[model samples]
Target: MSSTPESKPSALNPDNKKAPVTNSMPEHISLDKWADTGYEWAGEVEPSSFQRLATVLSTDHEQTKTQLDANLYRRNNVLHLAFTLTGNVWLTCQRCLQPVAIDLSDDYDIALLENESQVRLVNEEQDYLLLDEIITEQSPERLLPFKKLVEDEILLKTPMAPKHDDCEMTVEQFGEIPEEEESENPFAALASLKGKL
Candidate 1:
C-alpha cells in the first residue's frame, strides 16, 4: 500500500486555508491575514489557563474567570486590534495581606507591526505590537499565538501592588510595637562641650 502526500496537511502549502479562529481555540494565526479578513472572536476563558497570571493571584486558579471580546481589522494601511477584557481576580492586599477581590474590565486598541522598525512610525496616541525579529529569524512561523496574546493582556492589567480602598486590619493589629523612649538631644551635648572648651 502506498500513501499519498496530498492526504496529509502541510504548512508549506500557501493555497490551503486554515479553519476559523475562536476564543477557545489554542492556535497561532497570521495577524496580517486575520486583519485583512476582519476576524473576530468572543468567549469566556478560565483564569487557570493563564499560567503566568496564576502565579500572582491570591485565590485558587480555578476560582476566577475572564470574558474576551476581540476584533482584528486593517485600516489606513495599519492592522488594528480592538479588544475588551472583563473578569474578577483575587489579588493579595498590600496593607492587610489578605485576598482582595478586584474587578477587571478594560478596552484596548492596538496596532500590530510587522517589524520592530515600523513601531516608530505608529501613532503615539495608539498602542502597538512590535513583532520580535529574533524569534521570526529562528523559525518560519509568522503566526502569533492567540493564547499568549490573551495571557499578555491579562499580565499587563495585573496590578503591581493591589490594596483595598479601606482596610479593616491595621499594621498595629498584625504585630506588637514597642513604645519609643525620648533621649537627650546630641546637639545640646555638643553645645555644652563647645561652651566648656
Candidate 2:
C-alpha cells in the first residue's frame, strides 16, 4: 500500500526537518515516534543472524534469507505496526527427522499496547502487540530490538510438526519390526490342566 507522504515535522526534531534515518535496519527503534511520523523500514536478514532462530534450524545453509518490511503509523491514537516477512527455512521433518525446506511468507498488522490494561481497551476488531516491561521501559530510550520481533514472527509461522508432502522415508526406516512367531495360548494350557484335574 502506498500513501502520499505527509508533511509532518520529525518527532526527534521540533524544527519540522526530516529525521536522518538509516536505510539499514536498526537493532532497536522507538515505536511511539516512529509510528507518529509514519516511518517505514525494510531489509533482508539471514536466519543465522538470530540466535534463537538459529538454534531451531536444521542447518545454517547458505543463500537462505528473510526479506522483512515494517511500517509504523498511528490509527485512532493507537500505534500500529504492519510487517511482511518472506523466506525459506530448513527445519527438521517430524516424520523423517531430516531437513525439510519450508517456505515462509506472512503479513501482519497489530496495534502496540502500552500495558495489559490497554489490552482490554482494544476491541476484538483488531490484533494488538503487547510489549513486556523488559522491551519497553527497561530498554534504552524505550526502544525495542527489531531482531526479536522478526524472530518471533518467523517462529509463529513455523509448523509445529513439519513434514514433506511426499516423504521418501517410511516407517521401516526407523526400525525393523520383528516377525511374529505363533505360540500356544496360555488359556489352552490352563484348559488342559483343568481337564487333567
Where is model 2 more than 4 Å wrong at Cα? Answer: 1-24, 60-63, 116-125, 132-140, 171-197
Give lDDT per model, in order: 0.66, 0.69
Residue 115 lDDT (model 1)? 73
Q: Which residue pairs of candidate 1 clash?
A: none
TM-score of each: 0.67, 0.70
Error of 1 at 150 (Å): 2.5
Q: Which 10-residue span in candidate 1 carries the lowest summed lDDT?
A: 1-10
Give one clash count per candidate, in the order shown: 0, 0
Cα lDDT for residue 82, model 2?
75
Candidate 2 lDDT over 56-139, as tens digits, reads 788634547778777766666676667788878998888888888888788877777777777665678777776664374564
- Report how far off residue 35 is in candidate 1 (Å): 4.0
State the displacement of the C-alpha of residue 7, model 1, in Å, after optimal TM-score superposition: 27
What shift in Å separates residue 137 of candidate 2 from its native position after superposition? 5.8
Compared with the true structure, what per-residue lDDT tens digits does model 1 show for residues 69-114? Answer: 7666666667666778887888888888888777768998878777
Cα miss at 150, model 2 (Å)? Answer: 1.9
